[model samples]
Every structure is written in structure tokens, then in C-alpha cells.
Target: MDIFEFYKKMDADDIMLSFKGSVTSELLTSVLQIIEAKMERLNEPSKIKKKVYNVLVESLQNLYHHMDKNEQDIKGHSTVIFMIGNNAKAYSIYTGNYVRNENAEKLQAKLEKINSLNPDELKAYYKEVLNNGMMSDKGGGGLGMIDIARKSGQKLNFRFQQVDNEFSFYSLNINIAKQ
Candidate 1:
């Protein structure tokens, strides 16, 4: 990768943190801590910081658990990308990883449903899902996306690009306002 171009882009976007590689629990923890510290230094309000941190935890954990688990190499590596940035209006978090083509349609539909809900409807849906005790092998009852929507108060921007007959790249972008 062109390091200088990457650096310039990040600088221009006001990115606070970024990572592209495998996600391990240890690395996730360190990333969270680093971002928390950076936000503190930046004088971000505690409320915004907490919201950002909570949504981030869910986001990263989802990556760790629900991504293309079979794509890992002998080194336990899978390709993933994450970025966090801020501008005058908001803080933005982005994550991209591969998903099996079979799973992509389900994920797309779920995100669309979540995006369709209003805040109150989202809370009701969240509660309903929580109460149902239904969870996937990844231990998610579809609450992560809902929670991301509720916390961000913004529609999740996502895309799925076919990589082959078997897999597609999934990208999610979330923005949290300063207000």
C-alpha cells in the first residue's frame, strides 16, 4: 500500500484511528483503549465518547465473531478493515470484511429492516429480539445492528460487492453526531 497516500487521506479526513488486518480479542481491547485515550485527549464530551465506545465494542466484536470465519489462514488471519474519524458534524466509524455470498442477502435484508425503523420502533424491536432469546452461532440475536442504529441515530450505510461465487465484501459506515 502507498503509505504516504494513505496518511494524507487519513489526515484529510480527520481520522483518529485505523486498522486493517485480523481482529483478535487482545488487539480489539488495545484498539478500544487507544481510541478512548485519543478521544479524551481531544476533549470529546463524555457522553459522545461513551456512545462511540459502546458502539465500537459491538462493531468490533461483530467483526471478530460473524465475519468469514473460514477464510482464516494457518496463522489465524482474515482480512478486515476498520476506521474511526471525526469532522465538524460527527464521528464516523467504518468496517469492512468479507462474508459468504450465502450470508450476504440475509445481512442486507436485516440492515434494511433496521434502517427502516424509527427510534421508538427500533427500541421496541430491540426489546423483542432480546426477549426472544434467539441467537445465531455467533451469539448475536441481531441486536448489534439495531444497537448501532439506535446509538448512531443514523441509517447504516452498507454495501456488498461480489468477490466470487462464494464470497462478497461487506462494508458498513456509521456516523454519530456531536450533538
Candidate 2:
């Protein structure tokens, strides 16, 4: 969709909660609590709740670790925004954070690779990477995109917004069905 349409839909959706700040462990916990409470209020089934919870955790952790921060200031923290919403067909989770320009190209390539695969191919590729790829200190093992795609059962949607010469804002969207 075009940027205008995307923004319009976001504005129309019933945003249960939206958080923007440094993604520390404490902030992550608070965000999870808010999301869980919203899911509870919606009377979502346990199976759906589990899926949503897992996806949320992984997404937040990805942001906490991979997001780029300003280098000029020693105390500058990465900016992250998380939003949860539902439409007639699916529940949507969106995350936005800054990423270095160099990392943006790499991230785009990774996402494109994931988006190109079917379920079977994605599973096979994920296995291949898990078995052969070097793991980061966080133990990501290049699997976050695959995991998000597998759990959401949908193609990941992403975009990069230029912030300056050195970095851009990266936004990713994952959707899960109501059923």
C-alpha cells in the first residue's frame, strides 16, 4: 500500500496500546503486560495468545539489540515504537526503529530472502541457517525473520525511512489471523 493508505489504516485501527522509548528490559516487561491485558480483554483463546506473545517477545528483543543508536552522544538510546491492532481479518503488530544505513541494505536483503520463500522453503532455509550460520552474542543465529514469518503465517512487510546520511528508520509489520 502507499504510505498515505498505510497511515490512514493505522489511524483508523483501534490501537490497544502504543509505546515509544528506549527498549530496555523494564520497558519490554511493561509493554508485554499491556499487550497481555489487551489480549485478555479481547477474550483471545490461549492458542492465539501464545502465538502473539511469542511474536511480540521476539520482535521486541530484536529491536532492543539490533536497532541503531546515535553515536555522537554516549547516552543516546535507540528509538523504538510498538503498536498492536486488529482488523476484520487479522491482528497486526508493528515495530519501528533506527538502523544504520549500512545495516539497512543487509536487512533488506535478508527480509527479501525470507519473503521469497514458501512455507516449506522457509522451513528448509531456516534449518540450513540454524545449522550453519554463526550465532550472534544474543544467539539469534539469523532466525528472527524466519521465526516471525513462520509464526505470523504471513509475509513480513517492511520499509526504510531516511533519517539522515548515516541511518534510516526501519519499520516492520507482522499480521496474525483472528482464527
RMSD of each: 2.3, 4.5
TM-score of each: 0.91, 0.85
Provide the lDDT at 178 for model 2. Answer: 77
- In model 1, the Cα lDDT at residue 130 comes to 89
**Tens-digit per-residue lDDT, 1-179, candidate 1:** 89999899999998988989877889999999998998899899999999999899999998887544555522232678999988988889999988778789999999999989999999999999988958777757778989899998999999999987777889998998999
Q: How well does candidate 2 score on lDDT at residue 135? A: 88
lDDT of 2 by residue, 1-179 (tens): 49898667667885666778766878889888988987899888888888899888888888777543343432343667988877667778899987778888999999999999999999998899899989877647778889989988889999998878877889998988878
Off by over 4 Å in 2: 1-11, 67-77
lDDT of each: 0.87, 0.82
